[model samples]
Target chain A: MLLNQFLLLSALLFAMGVYGVLTRRNGVLVLMSVELILNAVNINLVAFGAFQDNVQGDVFAIFVIAVAAAEVGVGLAMVLLMYRNRRSIDFTEVDLMKG
Target chain B: MTSALLLAQVEFDVAQNIAFAIIAAIMLISAFKMVTTGNVVHAALYLVIVLAASAAIFILLGSDFVGATQVLVYIGAIIVLFLFGIMLTKAQLGDDDSVEKEQRSMGALVGLLLFVVMAFALIDTFGTQEIEFGNPEPIAYVAEPVDANDLPTPVREALNISANSGTVEISEAQFATLLPEVQRRVPGAEVRGNNAQIADAIFSQYIIPFEAVSVLLLAALIGAVVVARKE
Candidate 1:
């Protein structure tokens, strides 16, 4: 496969993720969008690792997965707290500091 | 090679490329649906497909270990976490109008702009580099003194060197440290397997970060318990 193919795919996926994050109102859905972005990054990392035939890329990709798992765990917990407090997960409502 | 007329080195496996195209198309469609779906449950379903397809892509890229982890961690655990979040938040199972903003054109515009910038940058920076894997051949000699018996049996017998000989052949790919001044670049041994290399890196150079991640996971675990508890 051409390096461009993988890179272009990753770029497109990342764009979709950005769109998801910008448009989604629910905190959990936005978190899902973040997962999309992370997965796109993993694709890029693995592709670069394959091109170089190096294991470092895969190592970091795995690390990204681990961190993402942790992120989701904490992120969802926060969402649960948001729902418990406000009876809603609407992200725009998170305005405790708003002037 | 500089001419825009000339294409990149077009070496690709026919079967693998076809597989890649098919899998990528599936992932793209599911991901698009995932982001656009109004129903939270439907979006979660779409995410499952996207995550599974991404795992396939990882395997296609020759990182089967990473692919397996993607399946196990992302789809198996993370997606479940997301669904639980949706359920607990009382997200409507039916299409919900409030899931999207009344004026969402900004996101579309930004996404388009980002894609264009990325396309231009990728094309400009890497126009002709082939996506080639390194050969697993041994291509270095340490030039350090070593007993002939220390060499692999095949190399030792093939070289027919005396036991007292100091120099030993080593593949630089196997031993990442290339003693530039003393090492002679030459094909002599085969590089180890891919998973072994990854395992070696994780345990050796990356040990600190590896342990740190474990600690982070533990912290996240405790933090989740503390934050999600009833107040």
Candidate 2:
């Protein structure tokens, strides 16, 4: 496959993820959308790594994956905590800081 | 006889093109479903399909190790954790009408705008540029001397053109055609597997980042436990 194909795929995925993050009110679903965004970045990194003559892109991708895991773990913990406190995880209703 | 060989190569390329089309179609459809689906559980399942297809794309790109890691890490560990999060939070799995807000149309507009911009940029920059798949000419010019005898005999046979003059001078088209055979013989050309190269690169050149990632993981583990623990 050409590089353009991979790039276009990642672009579409990233856009879809962005839309999900913007529109989804459920906290868990928002987190899942963030995962999609991260996966798109990973795809770009791995594709570049494979096309070029360096392993650094792959290394960066590994780091991205690791960071994404950590992010998801922390994000979900926070979501769970919010659910426990508010009895709901809807983004619209969790406006504790609203003045 | 040469025509027979050419026919086989054409068939292989056609097969690869078909496989890519199928995989990409699946990924795009499921990704669309993941974002637009009403059921949160169904969204998660669609995410799994997208991730699995992306992993398959990684494998097709000749990064088998990354593909496998993606499967193990993303689908195996992370998605399972997501499911746990949903289940623990008492999410209404069957009905998710409340998942989307009134801003959905605006979000779709933004998404479509972003897609158009990104796709245009990618095509404008890379429309005519083709990926040079497996040209070993640069390796002979740049790499430290490799002992042909040390390579597996079949791998040497696959790349024997480079063995004679220490540099293969094949045309780009010929090299492109020969890439799949060489990749089938060895995951990484002119050396050991890509996994080995990636490991060497991590431990040698990027050791600090490696250590940092480990520390990050440890902190995440502790943070998750503390944050989710009973008060």
Candidate 3:
């Protein structure tokens, strides 16, 4: 029962995250959506770990959290630099790489 | 009819269900807001609520370690990093009057489709199975009982008669008799087994991954510094 609930919730969260990533124009919001996707993955890991009577899933979740922290650290710094140079966080505005 | 009876029985344990339902609702609602809210700070705050609720759910699932780690790592560190990003990026503090409604509708459609597919998959895989989480059986080991003189016996008797028997026979009577002796030898080792066994596996067997995580953190720190450094 709990496992199903977890699966449902994780799926929902993941879907919302995907939509956010796909549609959002703000770079910071996109990063936040990525965080949501990472979190959904963590939930699935912990839920399956509990169901299987194994700690490996939990350990993997911890690793995911660590990776997420690192991602946010570098990602945010880049966003900051972009905003500083371009004076805007909108993805449409920063198309210097396109030309 | 039988399902109704089971539902009634579950109703008596409303405390557990209530917390689960509330947290699940909060998580879903905040996730929805995260995508819909144009204000970056508000979205980050909503994400914090989602993370905290998920952590609460982890605790309810008997994973205390994972729950605490989630709280510490996600809520404490990751959200703080997000806020720092918002601050450093000089995001407009006021209302974002520029979000395109057409994009939002398109995103909603995609999100809805993804949800339907995932829901179907979950139902296909786990819908028929019943969730069962009875209390775990206690671990038992044979050891010589200390005499009244506080002296340990040299030759330990194999109280585990099932192990000795070729047929692997163990009666309830034998288990009842052996239980006290097992408890004495392994003090505080109740029905849950050795919790420390997890720590042992992590430090001994999975030491490489643990060290690699530290290295990853170091690299991230350096990268953040490099990115943030003034030109």
TM-score of each: 0.79, 0.81, 0.80
List pairs with backbone clashes in candidate 1. B138-B189, B145-B166, B146-B166
The docking quality of candidate 2, as DockQ, is: 0.72
Measured with C-alpha atoms, the lDDT of residue B109 in candidate 2 is 94
DockQ of each: 0.70, 0.72, 0.62
- Cα deviation of A99, candidate 3, in Å: 7.9
Residue B229 CA error for candidate 3 (Å)?
Answer: 0.7
For residue A46, what is the lDDT in candidate 2? 84
- Ten-residue stretch with the least lDDT total in model 2 chain B: B135-144
Ranking by DockQ: 2, 1, 3
Report the CAPRI category for model 2: medium
Q: What is the TM-score of chain A in candidate 1?
A: 0.97
Where does candidate 2 chain A have its weakest 10-residue lDDT segment? A49-58
Residue range B1-231, candidate 3, lDDT tens digits:
999988976884476668888999999999999887878899999999999988987776666777898899889888888888888777876666465778778888988899999999898888855345444555554333333222212112434232223333333444456545454443222444324555766788889998998999999999999987888
Higher-DockQ candidate among 1 and 2? 2
